[model samples]
Target: KLKDAHCAILVVKMKRTLIMFSFILLQLLLGNSLSPKHSSPKPNAEVTVMGFVYCDVCSNNSFTRHSYFMSGVEVRIVCRFKAASSRTNEMITFSANRTTNEFGLYKVAITSLDCADVDSLASSCQAKILSTTRNEKLVDRL
Candidate 1:
């Protein structure tokens, strides 16, 4: 009879422990749901510009032995607004400067946040390719 009583007590304790653990887990989940660390940006969010330089057949014609010409190229990837807005401008202001690799490929990345700093110089905004120096000859984009 004593052994049976002890087993019952153990079972009760186990149930209480499980209930407490579940309560703590529920609290944690609820807390996180209430306050997210990084809320998603609104639709038609601010522009994030990324510039990539690549060498392609500059000529309109198809690839040929002599047609494999290389030239420094620059491109802009605009983040356009999804919906039209009266207050919003047609295009966001963004610019980046970068030099191409030996194979003629370079890239730059800028965010709308960067534009807030009026004192920020143009050189500061440019994405520097630290690995490749002016002397270094790169075969492809890194």
Candidate 2:
């Protein structure tokens, strides 16, 4: 009788373990299926570079400091494509003629040709913002 009881207990424990493992696997599978995979931009990404050009040191003269502020600060986006399959640098320029708005806002829509080149593209691009009125020091990132 004792041996039978031990056998039954072992069987129950085994069943419980199997059930727990199945539940965990189901949860993992569900989570994976629901989540979206990491893919490249679908050639329809509306890339915009918008920021305020403010003098960090000068807060006293708002009007005079930004009086000569103009738009179109020469923004260029270089899309680096350095994948395992690619040998050389496959950089694509999204916009060059585009410039910032009146309130210091710039928007550049990437072309389909540029987006379709690489499977995975860089999200944001490094830019050198240069203005004639401001000194070279002000020609920082955007």
Candidate 3:
């Protein structure tokens, strides 16, 4: 009789523990993540992004630092993300190029984000260099 009572008490304790654990899990999953720590901001929700492009003219020269603003380079907005299970990251790219004014200044308005990619748009927006008009060659010395 004592053994049966002990078993019943153990069962009751187990049931309460399971119920408490479930409630905690529900709160964590359903609660709004207002904390900045959990929030990955969808930044600069603007359609337009602007920047400059430069050529490392001295890419091969270790001792010299020489770079020039590239006038006709293609600058782009690129986004890369990968799921833990996926073999490779899916890259989404958007570009609208313009010939830089004499100053090597270029302004680009992202035309790619619309009905299809509105959600992931701001989260993955990044500026990148696409290509340059001048053929890149190894310069041995200045």
Clash number by candidate, in order: 0, 0, 0
Q: Please give, for residues 98-129, the per-residue lDDT of candidate 3 as tens digits.
A: 54556566665554343234455556556555
Clash pairs detected, candidate 1: none
Q: Which portions of model 1 show Cα errors greater than 4 Å? A: 41-142
Give the Cα error of residue 134 in candidate 2, in Å: 3.0
RMSD of each: 10.5, 10.2, 13.3
Clashing pairs in 2: none
lDDT of each: 0.45, 0.54, 0.55
55 Cα displacement, candidate 1 (Å): 14
Question: What is the C-alpha lDDT profile of model 1 across 31-92, one tens digit per residue?
Answer: 89888589776543233333333323344334434333233533322222222444544433
Q: Least lDDT summed over 10 consecutive residues: which range in candidate 2?
A: 132-141
TM-score of 1: 0.34
User: What shift in Å separates residue 56 of candidate 1 from its native position after superposition?
Assistant: 15
Provide the TM-score for each candidate, comma-separated. Answer: 0.34, 0.38, 0.35
